[model samples]
Target: MELWYTEKHTDSVKFSIQVDRQLYSGQSEFQRIDVFDSKEFGRFLTLDGYMMLTEKDEFIYHEMMVHVPMAVHPAVKRVLIIGGGDGGAIRELVRYPTVEHIDLVEIDELVVEVCKKHLPQTACCFNDPRVHLHFEDGLRYIRHCEDEYDLIIVDSTDPFGPGEGLFTKEFYGNCYKALKADGIMVNQHESAFYADDAIAMQRAHKRIVQSFLISKVYQAHIPTYPSGHWLFGFASKKYHPTADLNGVKWNALGLKTRYYNTRLHAGCFALPNYVEEMLRDAE
Candidate 1:
């Protein structure tokens, strides 16, 4: 039997996926974790009925999540990733030679285990020595952390369950505190097509803007996610994103990438007028 992955964007519109198989589905301490193998996306990861990642386009999400901020801040040496148990984000993060350490704070251990066992391609970064796996609440971890990291990426799931607090003002304040004075943070913001989630995105925008000197939203296309479009929030204390690529090499290792390129990097920041309007009206 074929299972379908569906996210109700609205009472009138919904984004759905047709899958070949359901690999895993159950309730964790926080929410439901569902893994599905799809004909188009290869494999799909879902949390609390919301689609998170898909095989065919996972690189787009992971690459933009890691590279955009890293490119802007060439001095990034230490990094923190919150709730990216699939390791896709880490896969992209470890590509930077300047990075000395990476602390991964994920609430659910099973998400890591499942991805490792079933989705090796996505879970490959778990073996990197630079990565420190911490199976703990991300908010709590960030709260106690001082000015330690150069970059912090909130690779969380949707903002409705265990991931809800991740989008809160308190958490944004903690993220601001956890980073160095010149540090930057990138978070997985929701899509603008979903009215309720779009509203949530507005609130997140406000919170980050209040906490950081530079706050901007970038866009990308992720078909697995609701609305087939996604946004990422970048907030920094001192540095603006375009400051300098003075002596930097974009893909130093020649690490093969599918979606992210220097051209696409700049293009992602070019938001449509409608998206800008949503953000403006949000303010």
Candidate 2:
């Protein structure tokens, strides 16, 4: 017999992977967590039966999420990450010598511990001195914070289950209040290829523009994720993602990033025709 792991991307569409073995499976206070080993993607983790990250392509998502904002504002010192329990985003963040502090607020503590045990590649950076772990609801955490962080990264799951609140307009308002004057916020904007995700992408874009002076969406090709085309939300109070970006300064950092580069950072924000219409009509 062969063991396979499957997730429903839609009612009629499903994705399956041939698993070498199941490393872990248990339910936390929040959702079901599972980790598996596969020949193609290597080790991977899922929350509530949804694929969160895989070892092979994990660098793409992590690099894109952390590098884009850092490139635009190299002076960023204080940062906050909400819902990145896997630690991939933080792994990229602590690389910047300019960063002085980072607060990682994750609602589920079990996800962090489990990932630390089985997904060490992405989870290895939790011990960085700059990172202060807070096992609490991110929505509630940001709601109570004011003018605290130079950047906020919402590395959340889909818009259902534990991640639902992070996608709401009210939460975006709280995130706006949680940022400094020129703060930049990046979030997991769902893909535009599917109907459900496109609706989510547009809705998120509409709500973010209400609170941010500059709002834009960017794309990344994550082969394991649904549709293989993923999007990220970029919003700021005072900087254009490209116009104010000092690419020359960012390149000078000389980081060895597999997926994100200075040129691609600006290019990703150039939305496709259909994607542009989706965001335009979202308002």
Candidate 3:
């Protein structure tokens, strides 16, 4: 028998993956967690029925999220990751010798445990001594700190359920308050092709623009995600992701990546006309 997993990106659109087998399924206090094995994607993790990471293409999302900012600001020593329970971001950050410590705040501990059990490709970095895991609300965890981390990555799910607060203006303000003068924040800005997801993307970009001095939006292609066009919000007090980007420094690292390179960093910031219009209207 053939088993498949389908997620409704919108009411009229659906994406499906054929599964080799079901590895895990259970309800955490926050949301439903599931893991499956597939021929194309290998092992994958989904939260509340939305795809999070798959072994085959996880590098694209993780690398773009971690490398873009690090290359822009290599002196970034301490980092904060909010809601990246799969640990893919941590895995990428750990590879940079300049990064000293990483604080990962995940609202649900079960997501971490399940990833460790079934999705170790992303979860394996948790064992590194530089990481400190906090099982608490990321919104609340960020509110009490000031001038702490040099970088903060809001690697959240969609703008509903457990991830609702992450897109709020108040939360962006708090993130602004939590960073140093040169801090940069990279967030899970939603997709631009669909109307529903576009609304979330606009609101998030608007709030970040209001909170930070320099805000830029970048793109990545993730096939499992809606529209296969994904965006990441880059907000900072000083550095511009492109102009201040140390391309030479990043290239000298000699990091071998599947989706990211110094050239793509500049090219990704070049938005399509419709996307440029959409972001301007977001202003």
Give the winner by lDDT: 3
Q: Name model 2 segments beyond 4 Å from true.
A: none
Please give the TM-score that candidate 3 achieves against the real structure.
0.99
List clash counts for every candidate, in order.
0, 0, 0
Q: Which order, best to worst by lDDT?
A: 3, 2, 1
Give the alpha-carbon lDDT of every model. Answer: 0.86, 0.93, 0.94
lDDT of 3 at 129: 94
Q: Candidate 3, residue 205: CA error in Å?
A: 0.6
Off by over 4 Å in 3: none
Model 3 C-alpha lDDT per residue in residues 34-122, reported as the tens digit of each score = 99999999999999999998899889999999999999986989999999999999999999988999999999999999999999899
Model 2 Cα displacement at 168 (Å)?
1.1
lDDT for each residue of candidate 2 in 1-283, tens digit (9 for 90 to 100): 8999998888889999999999999999899999999998999999999999999999999999999999997589999999999999999999999999999999999999999999999999899999999999999999899999999999999999999988899999999999999999999998998899899888899999999989988999999898999999999998889998898898888989999998898799988899889989986
lDDT of 3: 0.94
TM-score of every model versus the real structure = 0.94, 0.98, 0.99
Write model 1 residue lDDT over 1-283, tens digit each, in one string. 6677777777887787787889998788877888988787798888877777787888889998988888788689999999999999998888777799999999999899888987887899888899999999998999999899999999988777888889898999999999998899999989887788799889899888878888889999987677878999989988776554322476564666788777777778889898899988766
Clashing pairs in 1: none
Q: Model 2 misses residue 121 by how many Å? A: 0.5
**Considering only N, C-alpha and C atoms within 3 Å, which residue pairs clash in candidate 3?**
none
